[model samples]
Target: MHPREATAARLLKISAGNAYDPDVDIDWDAPQPPGIMYAPQERLSLFGTPLWDALTPDQRVELSKHEVASIASIGIWFEVLLMRMLLRHVTGLDPRSAHVQYALTEIGDECRHSIMFGRMISAFGAPAYQPAAVHRALGRYLGATAGGIQTFAAALIAEEILDALQREAMADDSLQPLVRMVSRIHVVEEARHIKFARDELARQVAGSSKPRRLYCQIVVARAAYTVTHSLINPQAYAAVGLDPARAGAAAWANPRFRETLRWAGSRVTTYLQELGLVEGPARPVWRAAALL
Candidate 1:
């Protein structure tokens, strides 16, 4: 069998043993802890900024809750987009192949996850925090066209960033109970998905010619920029009573926050480098997004 098929088979075995139903597993009835953060304190965009220092503790917690929920909302949007992309790619494949089967299983997992995120947003009383209107329209166009290694690698950017933040939240004792559960469930399942993406991406890169690799690199960089830049909605600050314009500018330009975003991106960057996807042309795009 091809290495891609072999990797897919291995992932299928893991999925069979570890797949989850968030609806059945999470206890939605428990009272989510109020007066506590919705994510780890440091993961908040303005965490170390002067604006963060100026907020009252109650306001900080409130903003953290909304910010975390907004991120989860973005997760839902990306998950839905990627699932459609995956399904579209596999639709013409041999149904008997492990690659096709694994794609179907991963889509099932994403469906549950998208539902879980929607539930979490409503449970926490957060507004439907979406990306800017422009991004939503762009996502639809990209979802239809991002079909190859670019799709998987771009998906990794979102998954790994969220995984970093969620891992922090899951370990924090003071975050809301609902947040902890969501973090835990997503972290566990995403591990398998990440593995599958990495394996498939490496397989594709190993075989493609220089021109094909270059094409993939450019497209992946653009997609990565779009996904990473859209994660934190500046309006999330306004929702909690801060001046969105000022706060968003501060968060983007803050040294500590830029470092945090870069750190969150480091793992993916290293992998892309190993795959020869982080060439000179792509570096500018990644750096512009503060992801390099």
Candidate 2:
């Protein structure tokens, strides 16, 4: 095998131990709560809108599941990208070959994640797969950009922010056992993924021209803000048979939702702060954007 392929195989072996087969591992018949099952305030606060109050308890449960699944899907996609990038870097292989391999791996991972989430919805008989409009748009925007350092920086921000959520979900005692288990497992692997992204980004940024570096930073920050805002998808309300417009407006106005929004925002803020990107004008932007 090519060295990169060997590396990927090794990583796959490691991941297999952590691989959760939803069909066999997750109990699809678990009892679900009837009311809104809020994630910890910290997790919810990441949004700018008041999603907590706008949602009925049951709706909240459905939205929460969707949120988790969204993150997992993103992770699977990131790995697919990473594996392709690695192949190009290591073996001088055609990018097409790398892309093909990456696509296969991503499809498999996404399928498993979808099944795991689908089973959770089955248990509750609730729809838990609402695609947040903002998220879709932001994803498309990022996809349009040339994939390189800028993409890597955005991925770094995204992974760190998500790691915070996964960590909280794993540790929160109120979560269902299955939910906690999934969160714990995801966080473990994601740590390595985030480190790889950050290190790669640092190297890429350092090697770029100063102008390019600044531009990349600006794009990354803006992308993070846009994606964070998209987290409050109005369509989620509609999935549970609620009026999307009213629920979206109500979610924005609700104090509880605001609180959760702030909580979630802090995770991103904290990550930026650690990276020294939260100073000067960026400070106010972070504060304003982080309403949870």
Candidate 3:
């Protein structure tokens, strides 16, 4: 039996006892706060830039609202991809096994999260912010071929980054109630999923040969770059009355944003390193992505 079977069984028990329904948990009919930011000021990509100083209060709040919506939309996109990878990975497992059951439970949670994100975006009146065409194609490839340590670790990385952001949003009284509620729901559910992925990744790494481990390190690092880069779409800036091209450039070069990426990536990278998935070949990509 795999090393993580016990971990899966325990998580399955926890899920059975405390799963949430976003439809019932989040009051969709509740009034959204008018002209309030959806995230903490410090989490804004251009928070420390001159462009940020030039913006009026209403514009800043609008930016936060759209930015948060884009983040939730991206969460949906990644959830769909991870669900496919998880389902494929568990295809041949025994139907009654805890591992397979927990995988399905994770998928069920993601489905609810996606629906919640969709409703949240609509309620905020933001346009759908999808990944670029090239990124979508790359995601399709990863979802199909990536399994074992690579699949779970990549999902964990994505979840952790969003978790960091949502944790802050959930606690900041300056933000809208709708945003905080959604963030709270996601954070609580995703914590269990993250634990399951981390455990599975460690077990998979322990079983892999050196060459296979190296391959996953490089591939998963590339996937990490894609996920970090795509979290916020450039079009989100246009919604706040800024030129997307100029704002994109400014945000990309912003030291604060780069710092945020590095800080958010550190925990996942450290864990990946411990699992032998952060070797020499992967280091440069991580650096270039500003995640190192």
Candidate 4:
């Protein structure tokens, strides 16, 4: 078996002791009162936007479904990536055992996250959409690459993006308690993952050549774009019985989408700036994307 797969299996074994199955773990009978999960003002970008108000009740429901699926899919991908990293660490290819172990714990946390999300879909009777092809390809490429620092950087970028969304979700007091709980749990664990990723990136970049640094920056930037664009998948809309093409087009064109991207980019840019990774032409692009 591949080294990463082996490591993932071992971690799964250790953490599987108290595994919670979605079928039996969650409170599916929990009450869901009829009201907006989040207030209009709670959504930073969509608040008072003409486009947002134009959405029908069904459309809004579809959008909410998309949001939950997006978060769950990304969470699963990150767990798999963490498993790969653990394999590298165990083989002595990387010396960051503590960080890798912490990430493994997070992976276990995400397993529960996936279950929660899946259960949410089951409760709502919405079909689950798969991740976008582009995003899946990007994740596969990142996972297939062999290098500790590179993997760490990819993971860092991902965690930073997630942190941005979680912050927004947590700030929205109008969100359902169950939704808020999931966001809170994710934010807590991601805080540690982000710290580990940033520290590792800084350590790796400190003595790197100019060319290597530039390469790393490019990789990180590409990963960010890949993730951001993936959020606009049409399948998510279709899964919830909405018109995929029209809804996706409207969603992609919506200013709220841009705002979501900005929210995600800002967190990434902040970390890059703190690490002194921003340089040359790429700095302006990163800044513009964040500040947009």
Candidate 5:
């Protein structure tokens, strides 16, 4: 078998053993424990801002709920785009190939994850927070046009960032049980998906010409900016009874939140930098996104 096929075959076997049905695995009906934050205190966008200090402890916890719901909503949005990109990726490829089969399996995993996110949003009684209109439209464009390495790079940006956050949440005993369980499930499953994307991306980048690699870099950087900026929707602030405009501005300007963005993105940025995918014009964009 080709080396790519060998890698895919290994992933496929691992996926077979590790796949989850979130609906069955999560206790959807379990009551959310009182006083528990939905995410880490430091992870909140308004953390260390005056806005954060003004809120009562209970209000801070509520804000965390809205923020986590917003993250899950974005996860659903990105997973849908990813599934579309994966379908585009498999077009004309041999359906029986291990690569194609693993891609299909990953799509199925994303489908469950989207549904799981929707359920979590419902459980929170929070509106499904969406990206701003312009970012939503940009995501649609990228979903249709992103191919090869661009697709995998974009996937890694969203996956690894969320994975980092979820990894922390799952291990935090102070968080809501619902959040912990959900994060645990997602973190476990996404590990395989991340490995798959990283492997495929390295292969594609290795074979790509300078021009194509540059194009992928620019596109992926812009997508990274969009994802980071859209993560904590202004609506999450609104949900917590704050002025959306001011809270959103604070988050963008907050040094603590900016540091959080860097921390969340550090792993993927290092990988992309090593692949030489973070150079050229993309460097400034990555810096602007606070992912450099």
Candidate 6:
């Protein structure tokens, strides 16, 4: 077997023993502790801005709930994109191979994760935040066309950013019980998927021709920008009775929020930089996305 297949074989065994059914594993009926925030205050988009200072503590907690829902909504969106891309990825490959089998396993994980996110949103009593029409169109395009390095790079961008935040969240004892449980489950399962994608991405980038490499650089950078910018829907602010436009402007301009973006993107960005996929025409886009 090739080295990639060997890695997948190992992953498959680990998954067999460790995969979670969120529906069964999570205590959906558990009582949430009152006065707990849904996410860390520092991670909230408007956390340090004037708008944040203007809100009462209760309002701040409310905003965190909505923001967590918005993030979960985006997670569902990206996982759907990932499911489609993974299907396309294995279409022409040997189905019996460990690599193909692991890809399908990941698809199963993503499907469960999407459902889990939807349930969490409903539980929060928040609106299901959809991406803007333009971004939905871009997602459709990427799902249909992204392959190899482009596919895995986009996967890493979304997964890594969320992973960074979730890792912190799961360990924070002050967060809502449900939020912490969900984060812990996701973080454990996603560790395998991240390794799979990172290895596959490195292989693809090493073997890709120059023109294909350049195209992937720009395309994946655009995806990174889109995903980063869309995580906090302006409508989330509106959910808490704030002006959507004003709150969004504050979030985009807030230095603390920008720093959070950088921190979240740092691991994946560094990896992609080493692979040469985050450079050339993509550098500015990464910077503009506050992910450089």
Model 4 Cα shift for residue 218 (angstroms):
1.7
Compute the lDDT of residue 110 as modeled in candidate 4: 57
Writing each residue's lDDT as its tens digit, candidate 1 over 145-171 gives 776687788878888888888888888
| Model 3 residue 15 lDDT score | 89
Predicted candidate 6 versus true structure: per-residue lDDT over 181-268, tens digit per residue: 8999899999999999999999999899999999999999999999898999999998678999999999999999999999999999
Which is superior by lDDT, 1 or 2? Answer: 1
Cα displacement (Å) at residue 169, model 2: 2.2
Colliding residue pairs in candidate 5 = none
For model 2, residues 121-143, the per-residue Cα lDDT tens digits are 45544443433555555555566
> Which ranking of candidates, highest lDDT first?
6, 5, 3, 1, 4, 2
User: Sorted by TM-score, highest first, which candidate order results?
Assistant: 6, 5, 3, 1, 4, 2
Predicted candidate 5 versus true structure: per-residue lDDT over 36-149, tens digit per residue: 899999999999999999999999999999999999999999999999999999999999999999999999989998998899999999999889898888888988798889
Q: Could you tell me the TM-score of candidate 1?
A: 0.95
Top candidate, metric lDDT: 6
Candidate 5 ranges beyond 4 A from true positions: none
lDDT of 4 by residue, 46-148 (tens): 3245545776765665566556655566556656765675466445434344444555565566567666766665665545556677767767777776355
* Model 6 pairs whose backbones collide: none
Clashes of each: 0, 17, 0, 0, 0, 0
TM-scores of all candidate predictions against the true structure: 0.95, 0.65, 0.97, 0.74, 0.98, 0.99
Candidate models: Cα lDDT each: 0.84, 0.54, 0.87, 0.60, 0.92, 0.93
Give the lDDT of residue 6 in candidate 5.
90
Candidate number with the higher lDDT (1 or 5): 5
Q: What's the CA error at residue 21 for candidate 2, in Å?
A: 3.5
Model 1 / residue 289 / CA error / Å: 1.1
